[model samples]
Target: MPNSPLHDWDLAPREAIALQKRLAGQVEREDRLDPVGRIAGVDIGFEQDGAITRAAVVVLAWPPGAEGEFEPTTLEIVEQVVHREPTRMPYVPGLLSFREVPAALAAFERLEVRPELVMVDGQGIAHPRRIGVASHLGLWLDLPTIGVAKSRLCGRHREPGPARGDWTPLVDGPDDEVIGAVLRSRVKVKPIFVSPGHRLTLPTALDWVIRCLGRTKLPEPTRLADRLASRRGR
Candidate 1:
């Protein structure tokens, strides 16, 4: 796996969080490049021993429009990284990005195709620090990215209407500043958490995610990465 200029395994847990917070404050909330070209997704899983960590990255050439299905001609890459199996990080409400970012970065390094944008299966600026795994990764890579999470991490929301495409703003705090959105990507299915990861806005992230959705619950790139990562277990 490629080493990140920002990574430091020697740092204590508290120091890591502080480093992440410090880095979070420096990210520019502006889209520096267009992401209508290729896209990638990353995911990580563990081996039976739980001491070995496996990560997979899948990059697909995405054309424009709903008909522009993610081509199966993806560059599927995988790698195994050292894992110490530290006690699961405390469910610190808004800091999961810290727990998972390291593994995700390892997976990202195995990618053969550098995508224009990367959609991570985690959070983004929708967190308490305005930075999550997606944001952290994007900043590190200097690439546009978005977070498409399966579960809500932090933020409040009114249940979206019972229909596909229905959504409501995700309130960050008491002031209700919209941080993200609860989008019903599929009818009758639980909503997906859509947030701006880096170099993109919440609306742009949602638009791209919707464009990438197919006849499945998750986006194509993410779904592909999940399958590829799972296959390493066998």
Candidate 2:
């Protein structure tokens, strides 16, 4: 599914903002996926004092017998890919995609199985400019993707109930636009922000993320990816 070229990562702050604005227009806020049998979680870890970036993608299989069932279950890791590369872009607020996505894309290229959907560990349309890492990479890969972020980059929302599957609409405070969701993945744990990255509606994104969650606060795919990325660079 590697269909198109992503924009250049190296750029000035002004140029990056411009790029985000241009790319944000292409993000699709509709459900555009067929039956998804596999999903991937993507994350990046830095080493060597941010000199080396290690990116990991872990794919999980969803057997056909049950879809949409959110019971606690173990999903098999069908494929995993990790790529280490020199860090090219410096950290910038709201432009974290440019800092990490190149390495993540390299790892994505090495994946033996292309996932039907990807869950990225960052924001999506929830950003100020509405082009977070998940949206950025999803557009480049041209696949259905969701953003499952631990913290907020933009928007405000009411705290969801302290129970699994609880969620509330995340709205842009200033514009009062519904952008994403605040989802409680586990009881008593901090909720994660869920947003549509590309080729998915906000509801669909939240649905898939909840389905992927087991006992952990984060979804299995993303939790595994986080572990993989965290351990690889150490």
Candidate 3:
């Protein structure tokens, strides 16, 4: 397991916002990722009446297949790990990492096979502060990561076409800066928000995410993680 203390997780809202501003600069929107083979998807779910935070990490070996033809049968699952800890922070709308990341770090600590890249189930730079959970965890783990959010947090974008490869730029309305991409991973299914977390560019993030797609709306790694996080609580 890899570990690095990037910052203190215990803080008030003001302090968390300040830390986000400082770390937002460290996020590299340009491509800095190595040749990826293993990819991990992470998700945090609450249990014990929202008092326990359960973080699940699912690692999958990237399959060699043609673009837009990702079949689940071809991919291999390398590892699946979960860690649980009592929730420390309240559910704040914008400061989600503060509430979710502590448990995620614990889950990462249990990982035996370090993934080359990680896919977090949250936003990256596509936030009001541009420091969502994906970016936050990436800075701590110092690994290439992507934000594979199921819904939009901030930014505006046209509805992507109902096709697997169709996408549109997710832009900040005020500055008109492109922050991420709204990608249609499965035909006629709701698109997922794809953003560069750390050590990755938006284009590369979308490419990898599209490659990881199977016969589901969410990618295989995050989808499996989501299932594990949900099912483990019961």
Q: For candidate 2, write residues 141-209 as lDDT tens digits.
A: 999989989998888789998878989999996679998999989888889999999999998998888
- Tens digits of per-residue lDDT for model 1, 1-234: 147553463355677678778988876676666645678887655666455555666777767333644323333333222222332233355666555666666666655557888888878888877888788889878899888888887899999998767889999787888888898878789989889889888888888888788767788777777776666423
Q: Supply candidate 1's per-residue lDDT for 111.
A: 56
TM-score of each: 0.81, 0.92, 0.92
Better of 1 and 2 by lDDT: 2
- In terms of lDDT, the best-performing candidate is 2
Better of 1 and 3 by TM-score: 3
TM-score result, candidate 2 = 0.92
What are the lDDT figures for the candidates, one per model? 0.72, 0.87, 0.86
Per-candidate clashes come to 0, 0, 0
| Least accurate 10 contiguous residues by lDDT in model 3 | 1-10
Model 1 C-alpha RMSD to native: 4.5
Show where candidate 3 strays beyond 4 Å.
Answer: 1-7, 64-68, 232-234
Residue pairs in steric clash, candidate 2?
none
Stretches of candidate 2 off by over 4 Å are 1-7, 64-72, 232-234
Positional deviation of residue 138's Cα in model 1 after best superposition, in angstroms: 0.6
Query: How well is each residue in 1-234 modelled by candidate 3, as lDDT tens digits?
Result: 134352478789999999899999988777887778888999988788998888999888865444346555556778888888778889888899998888888888898888889999999999898989999999989999899999999999999998787999999967798989999888878899999898888889888888788888888888889988886522
Any residue pairs clashing in model 1, and if so which? none
Error of 2 at 156 (Å): 1.2
